[model samples]
Target: MARIERVDWLMVDLAPKVPRSDAIQSFVSQETPIVRIIDSDGAVGTGYSYTIGTGGPSVMALIERTLAPLLLGREAEDLEALWRDVLFVTHATTVGAITAIAMAAIDTALWDLRCRRAGLPLHRLAGGAQASLPLYTTEGGWLHLEQAALVDDALAARAAGFAGAKIKVGRPLRQDVVRIGAVRAAVGDAFEIFTDANQAFHVDEAIRRARAYQELDIGWLEEPLPADDIDGHARLAAMTTIPVAVGESIYSPAHFREYLQRRACSVVQVDVGRIGGITPWLKVAHMAECFNVAVCPHFLMELHIALCAAVPNARWIEYIPQLDAITTQGMRIEAGRAYPSEAPGLGIAWDWAAIDRLAIGAGQVTLGSSGGKR
Candidate 1:
C-alpha cells in the first residue's frame, strides 16, 4: 500500500584532474544529479540523470517543478502509468535533453522501488543468472592521450582484472591506427580490445579503419558512423570480419527495431536513460536476443550490470569508475567484473550530504513548467 509520497532532486559535480573528450567536445568536469523518491512507507529509492555542467540546474528544475507535482499522491505500484503520464504531458518537448533526462530520474527511482519491494537485486528480478558481471575499462581511447599514456592505460586495465578495454579512435587515419596497434601489442591479444569512433567517420573511412585494426584481433568497432546511418552500418557489418556496433544515441525501441531489422551492427549499445527506462530497456534486451545480436550497453554502467547478467547475449558492460564519488556503497569491481550488493533496491544509494553541497542556483528551475517535465 505504499505510494510515492515525495521526490527529491539533488545535483553533484565532480572535477576531473584532466579534460575528457570525444569527437565533439572535451569535459573538464561533469555533473550527475541524483533523483530520490520516497514512498508513503518511508522507503527511499535513488536514480540519476546524465548532464553537463550548465544543464544540471535545468534538469533538476524540470523534475522538481514539472514531474514531481503529478506523482505527489499516486500509487507507487502504477509505475508504467506514471511513466506514460509524464510522457504524454511532456509530448511536445520530447525531442531533447530536458525530457529524457527527467524520465531517466523517475524511471530509475521507480525500478529501485520495485527491487526493494521484491527484496531482490535488480539483476535477479530481471532473471539474471550471475550476481557478478564482467566489466571492461572505457575512456581509454581519447585522442588527447599520448601513445605511452594509451599503452599504460591498457596495461592498467589488464592489471585491474578487466577482461577487455575500449578506447576512442576518430582521429586522422594513421594516428588512430598507431594507437590501436599499440594497445593491441600491449594487451597481447588475450585481452579483448574494442574501439569507438563516436560517430566520427564516413562509412568508407570507418570501413577502412576498422579493416586496418581488424588485424590486431580487435573485439568490436562501436559507433563507427552516425547512429542514423543504419544502411552504412549494415554495409560495414557485412564487409568487415570485425563486428560493427551501434546505438547509444538512439532514443526508442522503434529506433532499435529499425537498426535490428536492417542488420545494422553486430553489437547493440543501449543507454538506460535515453531509451526510456527499465521497462523499455528490458524490451530492447529481449529484442537483441531475438536477433542474436550482442549488447554492450553505453555508460552509467553500474545499472546495466544487472541487465547484462539477465540477458544471455550481453557481452560486456563498460566501466568508467568515475561515478563512485557520488554513490554510497560503491560497486566493487573484482577482476574486471562488478559484484552485486545485498542492499535492497538498486544496490546503490545517494550521498545526500555531498549532493546538497553541489547545488548551483534556484528558480532557474520552475515547479510544474509544462504539463510536467519528463
Candidate 2:
C-alpha cells in the first residue's frame, strides 16, 4: 500500500513590484506557502496556496495544526476521497480564504501527485481539452502610473508578442475612456484590449465607464464594482455592450451562483486560490460552463493554465511576469499565448532553495494526522 508519508510547508517571499491599482489591499511582494507531499516510496508532489501579507499566517496555522495530522499515512491514490475527507473533518468552519488556502495547498499537491504518477502533464492528467491556450498581458496596466508610462507599458507588451493587453481603470469615467482610447490607438483595433476596475466604482459609475469604452472594443470590464453588488453587476452587464467580468475576490460557489443566476457577468474570472483549491475551482469552472460564460481565470496563473486547458470554454489567461522571480522555471509566454509544460506534475516546480532564503517565519502550516472517521 502506497500511503502518504510527509507534508512540508515552505514559504517564499517575492521582491516588491508595482502595486495593483484599485484594490484596497495589495501585496508588497508575493509570498507563496508551498505545500510538499511525499508518498511512501519517496515520490514527491508540490502545490502552492495564495498568500498575501496578513492571510498567510492563519492559512499556515490551519494546515499545520488542523490538517497535516489527519493526512499522514493515508493512501496517496485516493485523491478525491482525501479532498472530501479533509472537508468533512473541517466541515463546520471550512469557508473563505482560510479554507481556500488550506484546500488549495493540499488539492494542488494531490493533483501534482496524480500527474506525476501518471507521467503526464497536469493538463493531460485532468483531461486535456486543448493543446495550447491563448494568453493576454495583465502586466503594466496600472492607473497609478503616469499616462506616458502606462502607454509605454502597453506598447512594450505588444512588442513583446502579446496579442492582447489589459489596463487598469476606475479613476473617473473619462480618464478610463482616454486610457482605453490611447491603448487602442497605439495597438490598433486589431489587438485585444481589456480593463479591470478592481471593484473601485459604484454601480452607476461602472455602467457609465463600460459604455464609454465600447468604441475602443475593450474585451471586458472586470470587477467594475464590489463583488457583493449582484444587482450592480447585473445592471452593468445589461447596460453595457462590453462584457462584464468578475470573480477574483468572490469566496464561494454560492457567490458564483448569484452571478450565474443573474447573468451578472459575461465572463467568469475564477482565481484558484481565492475560491479554494482545484476541486472547488473545477466546480466553479463547470458552473460557468453550464451557464455558457467565458472564463478568464484571475491569477496564480501557473495552475490556471492547466485549468483553462482542461475546459473548453476557457478564454484568455492573465499574464503578470512579476511572479517569475519567485518561481524556479517560470512559465513561458510567447506571442501572447501561454504554453503548458510537459513535466510530470504541474510542470514548473518551486525554487525551494530560493523559498528557504525568502522564508520569514511569519506563517505556519499544520495538517491533521489522526486516523479518519471511517
Candidate 3:
C-alpha cells in the first residue's frame, strides 16, 4: 500500500480574453484551485476545481486547513475511503458548494494516483466504457453575442467538424426564437443545436420558450428552470417533447436522485467538480443509466471527456475551453468527436508556470512526510 506522504494546493485565477455572460452571470475568470498529492513511493498526481470568479480562496482554505491534513498519513489504497473521510468531516457545511469543491481536489488527485500507478488512462480507470464521444461547443453562443455572431459561431463549429453548438437562451420569446432560427438557417438542420437558459425562467415561461425551441428541432434545452424546482422541471419536461437537461447546479448525488426519481430531467449534465469529484460523478452517471437518460456533462471538457466516455449512457461532452490558459495542451478533438488522453493517469499536463503566474498564492501550504507545514 502506498502511504500518503504530502499534499499542497494553490489558486489560479485564469481570465478569459473576452469576458462572457450567460443568463445568470458573467464569467470573469476561471477561479481555479489546484491540488497535488505525493505518495510514499514518490508518485505524484495533480487535480483541480474551478469557480466562476469566486470562492476559490475558500476552497483552498478548506483544502489546506481540513482536507489536506485528513489525507496525510492515510493509506491511499481506497479512493472511496479517503473521499468519505473528507466528506463526513465537512458534513456540516456540505450538501452545498464550498465543501464539494474542496473535496473535488483531493478526490481527483487520488484518481490521478490510481491511474498513474496502474499505467492506464482515466476513462479505463473509471469504467472503460468508450474511448471517444461526440463534442459540442458553448464558446460562441454566450448570451451577450449578437445573433449574427451566434450564427457565425455555429457555422464555424460545423465547418471545423464539431457535432453541435449550444446557444444560450432566456431572451424575450420572439427574440430567442429568431436567434435560434438564424443559427439553424446558417448551420443547416444536420448539425445539432442545443439551447441553455441557465435557470432564467419559471415553469410557465420555460414551457413557452421550450415550445418555440421544439419547432427548431433543438437537441435539448438545458437548465430551463432553477435546479431546486423539481416539480417545475417535471412539469416542463412533461409538457414539451424537447428533453430537459439539468445537473450542473445540483450538488449531491441525492439531489440528482430527486430529479431522476421525479422524472424531471432527461439529460444529466453531471459536472465533476461541482458534484464533489469523479468518485461521486460516476455514481450519478450510473444512477442516470438506470432510468435510461443520457449523460452529457456540463464543462471541463479535458476531464469530462474521460468521465463521459467512462459511462455507457453518455453520448456527448460539452466543450468549454476553461483550462487552456493553465494547461500545456488541449484535449484531442477530431471530426466532431472528442477522444480522451490515452496517457497514463489523468493526462492533463498542467502549465505550472502559467498557473503560478495567475495564482493568487493565498492559503498555500505544504505538508511534509512527517506532517505539518514545512
Candidate 4:
C-alpha cells in the first residue's frame, strides 16, 4: 500500500465574473483553500473548499496546524478511516463550517488519490450511476438583477440549452411574483423555474410566498428559512406543494438525517465542501435516497458533476462556474444535461500557473519516522 508522503495547501482568491448577491449575503470573492496530497509512489491528488468572502485563512490554518499533520504517513487508501481520525482529532470544532471545509480539502484529495490509483474517473470510482444529469442556471439569477435583465438572462439560459433557471426570491412578495411571472412568460411553462430565498424568510412569510409561487408552477422553493430550523421547514413543506430544498448551509450527515427524518426538505442541496467531501457526501446522498428525496447539489459544478453522476437520486446540478477562470477544462452541457469527464480522478485540469500567480500563501509537510519536511 502506498503511504501518504506529503501534504500541502494553498489559498487562492478567485474574483467572481460579476458580483453575485442573494437574500442573505453578496459574494464579493471566493476564498478557495486548496490541498494537494502526495503518496510515496509519487502520485498526487488535488482537492479544495471555498468560502464566500472570508474565513478561508482559518480553513488553511486548520489544515496547516492540525489536519495536515494528522494525515502524515497514513495509508493513502484508508480514506474513511483517515476521515474519522481527522474528525475525532478535531472533535471540539466538529459540525462547523471551518472544520467541515478543512476536512473536505483532505478527504477529497484522498478520494482523488484513490480514484487515480485505480485508474478510473471519479464518477466511475464513486458509482457511475449516470453519465450525465440535467442542468439549471443560477449565474443569471442573482438578487441584484433588474426584472428585465433577469427575464432576458433566463431566456438566454434556455436558448443555451438549459432545462431550468433559478431566480432569487426574498424581494417584496409582489416584486418576486412579478419577476417569476415575467420569466415564466418569457420561457413558457415548458422550462422549469426555481427560486432560492437564501434563508431570508420566516415560516409564515415562506408559506405565503410559496403559496403565491405555486400559481406559477415553480419547480422548487429553496432555503425559505434558516437551514437549522427543521420545524420551520417541515411546516413550510406541509403548507405548499413546492418542494423545499436545502443543504448548502448544513455541515454534517447527522443534520441531513434530522432534516430528512422530519420530512423538512424535499430536495437535498448537498454542497460537497460543506458536507466534508465525497466520503460523507455519499452518505448524505444515500440517506436522501432512502428518504425518497432527490438531490440538486449547490454550486461548484466543476467537481460536483462527477459526484452528481455517481448517485442514482441526483436530480439536477446547479450551474455556477466559480472555477472557470482557473481551470483548463470545464463541465460540458448539451441539451440541458451536464456530461461528466472521462479523465481519471476528479477530472479537473487545474491551471496551476494561473493558480500560483494568484496564490496568497502555501505550506507543506512531509512524512517519515519523525515527520520530515522537504
* Best model number under TM-score: 4
Give the per-residue Cα lDDT of candidate 2 at 242.
92
Which stretches of model 3 miss by more than 4 angstroms?
Answer: 362-374
Q: Lowest-scoring 10 consecutive residues by lDDT in candidate 1?
A: 362-371
Off by over 4 Å in 4: 369-374
Worst 10 residues of 2 by lDDT: 365-374
* lDDT (Cα) of model 1: 0.76
All models: lDDT? 0.76, 0.77, 0.87, 0.91
- Stretches of candidate 1 above 4 Å error? 361-374
Candidate 2 lDDT over residue span 146-183, tens digit each = 66777787788778777787888867677778877877
RMSD after CA superposition, every candidate: 3.2, 3.4, 1.6, 1.4
- Candidate 3's C-alpha lDDT? 0.87
Return the TM-score for candidate 1, rounded to 2 decimals: 0.91
Candidate 4 has its poorest 10 consecutive residues by lDDT at 365-374
Candidate with better TM-score, 1 vs 4: 4
Q: After TM-score superposition, what is the CA distance of residue 208 in candidate 2 from its true location, in Å?
A: 2.1
Per-model TM-score, in order, reads 0.91, 0.92, 0.96, 0.98
Residue pairs of candidate 4 with colliding backbone atoms: none
Q: What lDDT tens digits, residue by residue, belong to model 1 across residues 222-290?
A: 888888788888888888899888778877778898889988777888888777677778788889989
What TM-score does prediction 2 earn? 0.92
Candidate 4 lDDT over residue span 234-256, tens digit each:
99988888999999999989999
Candidate 3: tens digits of C-alpha lDDT, residues 178-241: 9999998888889999999999999889988888789999999999998889999999989999
